[model samples]
Target: MMNLILHGYWRSSCSWRVRIVLNFKGLSAEYVPVHLVRGGGEQYYAEQRRINPMAQVPTLVVDGRSISQSVAIMEFLEETFPEPAMLPRDPYQRAKVRQLVEIVNSGIQPLQNLSVLKRLNSEGWDSDRVQSWAADWIRKGLLAYQDEMDSVGAQYSAGDSITLADAALVPQLVNARRFNVEFEGLSRLVEVETRLMNHPAFASTRPELQPDMEK
Candidate 1:
């Protein structure tokens, strides 16, 4: 049996993405909490930096080999497990799935992540200003995501089946709600999120249910 260990924080959207993938694949990994805020961010410590050079959460250590970044970890798991696939088989469909995934992974999540927010704070941005900044970026990316959904199927981000796009979208929605980002024109995303959240993999692995979740 391959021993899998996941080092992450409860509320980190990237970490939450990996959690959803793990649950969807029915894989179990020992969870290790890395508090992103406590004591000036534990991820900066030498131990975690060694494990993940980027010092990011959702670092998947598989049989002693560590892989950082949520998308990378998700792909690794999908390629290794193969069963209960999270990506489509057709070339075009697979590319579409990756496009949607990147819409969230690359376009949306980074601007509002903890480190970026912390940097804004250091640069003298007040709480309200920082929140507004984050919300604006989220809105922009979500609008683009909504536009792309015209090509996707109705039920989920990509299609009727849950794909990597759904895994990426759900966690970003969580962050959107956190920043109070308006969803007026993004009804499709909201509807898709409603359906996705009902799935056991998404519902069970929510940040609130994680063992390291804070009250």
Candidate 2:
């Protein structure tokens, strides 16, 4: 029996975060695709809702307990399987990783999530307008990221090693592209994104390659 079961959508950045972590840790899961769009989002359906009241993807069920939220799930995985150590051992360095992670998780992602965009669409925003809204917020948050990277830059988001921040960043960059967010002058970010996207841990988890994807 598979010990870990992940409930996620192919294109969801939050779900992508967990997927990258799973791959980085050299772990495998029974991937249960919860289509976020079909049938008005399978996440809202009673079955998935029973696992995650928030009706969100990236829910990991392990040892008869369900864990929601991608960051929370990553933390759980870090504690249980700490060999590769997605976080640093030093408390301060770990906090730095979390800091960059939050800039993506709370700062950027919420502004353009499926629910928020759906609300905007229902409020009579056209596709272009909705894209503009997403692009605007993503640009602002990524600007902050760029500034931080310029200050204490490294091969990855936090430092020389691949930390939780890098996991958060690559997915957000994908979202930026999906919404056509222009991040001109953010060369450091662009470089890091390009390198990670091609890395095996990141490449194989792309939305297009997922089992649930149609194209």
Candidate 3:
């Protein structure tokens, strides 16, 4: 058995975070697809539910011990493996990297998550309206990120190398573009996301490459 089992949807941003970390660290694990759109999404399926009561995708099971939250999973992998480090070596710098990532993980992503969209749907919001909500939050959140980019520069989110922030940035950009949230101001992010798209680890993990993707 692969030591880790990733219960996630290919299109999920949170799931993508963990995927990037796994690839960056050269960790191979079982990919367990959970269709987040079918049958109201397999994340809600009873079996997956037992492992993750929150019914969220990107749940990482290590040695059959479950973990939730993308950042938590990222940190866990970093600690467990401790090779080809994903976080910066400097403690304060690493915290800064994490702070930038935090804005995305907690501040920005939740506003646009599937469950939030589903709730808006129950309130009679259409797809267009829901996407508008996503775009609104993403635009503002990324402007804040633009400031980070201005301070941090190109090679990294907080420093001159890939760190926690870069891992978080790529998938969020994908989501932003999907919702028509422009990346105009955050030029550095666009540059980085493009680079990451071609990167060996990032390229292989694109949502479109997943086994169950719809044509």
Candidate 4:
């Protein structure tokens, strides 16, 4: 049996990133769904919070130790299972891949996360205002993402070979589409996302296909 246990919600973009990386590495884990909306979030429960103090999804348990954060989990997997590597060997290329990953992870995803939007709602922001808030950040981040891609993008976000950046891009685009973010000038990034959507490894882990995804 696999020693890995992954706790996450199906619709969570961060969780989606870890799922993609696990598939890319040809690894399997016992998936434990932590419903983000049910009962005001299962992550906040004491049991789940013990595993991840942040009360966030996508916490990974490997060899009896808990690892939080999707990017960190992916990095651990990359280091432990290096075959069919997702990152390039060259130092410069590796840094470039991380740069792209951070653009989505820190820049785009954070600004559009459910918690942040809900906080806006709690602060008396209407749905349209919340959407505008997300759209503005997503648009600027994606435009910046496109510019970075133009310099080094290939079949994937980084190059012909898939990398950490691709793992981050697909899910960010999903959020973008959900918010109706415009893509008028992001053809390259869109093409990369399109290819990933068709890729078996990435496709299988989509939110709709997850075990916990509501029908």
Best candidate (score: TM-score): 1
Q: Quote each prediction's TM-score.
A: 0.97, 0.95, 0.94, 0.96
Question: lDDT (0-100) at residue 160 of candidate 4?
Answer: 89
Candidate 1, clashing residue pairs?
Answer: none
Q: Which digits, one per residue and each the tens of the lDDT, describe model 2 over residues 1-215?
A: 43999999988999999999999999999899999989989999998999999999989999768999999999988898997988989998888888889999999999999999999999999989999999999999999987776245577777777888889999999899999998787778988888787788889888888999876
User: Best lDDT goes to which candidate?
Assistant: 1
Ranking by TM-score: 1, 4, 2, 3
* 8-112 per-residue lDDT for model 3 (tens digits): 888898998898899988987798989888898888899889988888888999998999889999999889887888777878777888888988998799999
Comparing 1 and 4 by lDDT, which wins? 1
- Please report, as a residue range, the 10-residue window in candidate 2 with the lowest summed lDDT: 146-155
- Per-residue lDDT for 71 in model 2? 97
Candidate 4 has which clashing residue pairs, if any? none
Q: What is the Å distance of residue 63 in model 3 from its true position?
A: 1.2
Winner on TM-score between 1 and 3 is 1
In candidate 2, position 203 carries an lDDT of 90
lDDT of 1: 0.91
